[model samples]
Target: MKRLTIAPDERRHIERLVDDVLAEHGHWDPVQFVTQAKTVAESLPLRVRQFFRQIQSEESDVAVLSGLPLSPDLDATPTGWDMAQKTGAGRREEVVLALCSAALGEPFAWGNQQDGRIVHDVCPTPGMERSETSGSSTAPLSLHTEDAFHQCRCDYVALFCLRNPERVGTTVVRADRLDLPAPLSGILAEKRFRHRPDQSHVGPHGHSADVADLDAIMFGPPGSCYLRIDFDDTFAADEDDHAARDAIKELYRHMCDAVERVVLEPGDAIFLDNYRVVHGRDPFEPRYDGKDRWLKRVNLIRDIRRVFLSTGVRSRVIS
Candidate 1:
């Protein structure tokens, strides 16, 4: 993981930039701001710009920027993403993330998730404590590649910490760190796995029919490979292919063995390379006293054209 700490002066510069953004746009509409964000991001502090440039150039597995400016009068953690959206809580933080994320790649969203909001609120909800989505508090979110089912899944998953009284840990497993046997690696390289859209993407219309595409669990070169698998949603393409099933089980074991934990503090934002890292969260009890763990998340793709071509429209939100 690569890390950078923003100096006091840099933080102040960022705050000014954020203020200018909020002042110009009255409402926090990232969809409208995205095209402008890239231009705005060019004005970020030199060190900060260099940091993100290094991350992109090196394809860093996990990178973090610390000491970002948080709002002094920040609102309480919303009960869920819906509550945050309704109240527009943490709007400034959303701009902070969007601007910083723009330094790396183009931000995008899913129409089926969080009402197509470019930046999503990740906080525990009352009844969804045990669910598989980000709202879950009690269940240990299984480490998986973000949006593993989608062809245009983000190249990076940026998460900004707002509040975390419990100091919950964000778990990660790096693909480059795994050292599997040649036999197992060979099996995973084959196209024997199917990735299904996670819980967050399934809307009232139900799961998309095209999610059953067969793909390899690991891809790219031999030593440094990219991963795409969800423990809950990915399965062997052929039920009768016991070898494929066994390979997935073996890969899961390797993933568990290679797990690493990162505890993010307020004002710290972590950008996980979706292709190189699988991330999850450790289970923690939610107090629901408006002080529960809260985070802002955004998905970034290397190029916006992929989304435009996929949707057959020049929009960031994928329907």
Candidate 2:
């Protein structure tokens, strides 16, 4: 894991950058802002820009940037993402995330998730407490690769914490931390596993027949493996494939043993390399009294052409 805390001067400099963008734009339009974000990010503090550059070149598994600016009069947490969206809560922070995310990669969105918003609101929503989506509070989100079912899945999942009064921890497991035996690793390297879209993409009652894809659990150069698996939705392609099923179970056990928890405070943003780290959240009781944990999430890819090639369009949103 790698982390860089913003210095006092750097924080104020970032505040000025965000203010300038907001003053020029009347309203928050991430779709429009995304195109210019990378160019604007060049104006960020030199130290901050260098930090992100190093992470990109080194392929850091998990990285966190702390002490970004937050509104002094930030609004109370909304009941759900829809409420946050309708109220335009935390617009400034969203801009902050966009600027910083653009430094790392091109920010994108999923058409079927979070209403196709480039930035997504993650908070506890009533009636979804035990569900599998980001709205869940009591149910612990299982550690998994973000958008594992898609070939064009993001390269990084950027999560900026706006409020976490309870200090709920985000669980993470790095691919390098697992100590799998050769037999299990060999099985995982084969293309015998099927990944289904998570509930966030396909609602609780929605079917996964349309988005299931078969791929390897682990792939890449020897001694350095990349991982892609959603424990809750991934399964063996053939129900009779007992070896693949057992390999999945064994991998889960290894991940459980190597799990690490990161508790993010306000003004902190974490970028999880989607291929090298699987991340989830710890279950917490929701107060819903305008103080529930809230975060802004953005999916980023190393290049924008990946999205264009996959969607056959030049837009950032994958439809």
Candidate 3:
């Protein structure tokens, strides 16, 4: 849970990196951009290494680097046809990933938004809901992991705020630095509760009845953990596991009480060590007037040895 504020010099370096990548790849050619990005990625210094190491060890760590000096000429939508038809944002994303990979000592893979991609939708939707009568729009979201169901769970999930809600929609993060009560601890440490996969994102393959019974210990190793949480009211455990389920709910409630709420403004990015914290959002009335809170979500799988062609892809654009 330590804070790694970027030193003035280091901040300057990161800005330079961003600018150089933009100028080289953003306006030129895709082939050139990708080639230059790989070249730049190889020369990263030691300070960047230390910075990522700190985050890898303490998943709840945060860094606030201001005065990023973005391109004034850059449009709100950086990857319009002008850019995509020529250079493409795929190369831009790769440049960003390379920067992060240098910082984290892990190869970073992206999620694509193309059709039939292996992207995971971590939010709630209507058809996927268990009951229509819940009728709650702005209820407080509980703390849970992103995709505990996937076998190759994520190592880190980074959310870069392109925009913020006009009203609420605060992000609540539960840090592992806090101690859990005995009853809740026992429940989380036990592999008794079951979780159902969200079918809406799983396509029309019909509901897969595979259930996941997880140990509440939250993580497997000191720094390795997987998140398996869903808000669908239909997902429930059997009668025999009722006590364990109740205990899990109680644990979540208690953790929620101690959460730190952060309202992310534009340009603010939060890197969540998937093993160290649980995150959720507070709902707000969306204006739907083009300004409705839009955030760019990017997930990074840290383990370089495990990268597979079928596992990493982007989420679909919900238009």
Better of 1 and 3 by lDDT: 1
1-319 per-residue lDDT for model 1 (tens digits): 9999999999999999999999999977889999999999999999999999999988899999999999999999999999999999999999999999999999999888999999999999999999999999999999899989889899999999999888999999999899999999889999988988899988784357757788998898755689998999999998999999999999999999999999999999999999999999999999998989999999999999999998799999888
Model 3 clashing-pair count = 8
Ranking by TM-score: 1, 2, 3
Error of 2 at 101 (Å): 0.4
Model 2 C-alpha lDDT per residue in residues 73-161, reported as the tens digit of each score? 99889888888789999999999999999999999988878778999999999999998899999999998899888888999999999
In the predicted model 1, the residue pairs found to clash are none
Which one wins on TM-score?
1
Best candidate, lDDT: 1
What would the TM-score be for candidate 2 when compared with the true structure? 0.97
Candidate 2 vs candidate 3: the TM-score winner is 2
Error of 3 at 215 (Å): 4.4
Worst 10 residues of 1 by lDDT: 203-212
Candidate 3 lDDT over residue span 1-319, tens digit each: 4434446676567667766877755554322433244356555445555656677665544443222223333223322222323433233333444454435533332232222222112222233223211111245454555544444445666654444545344444445445667666655666555565433224444223345444343545643443345444223355566776676666566666767767665545566666566666766553334344433344456644454533443211121
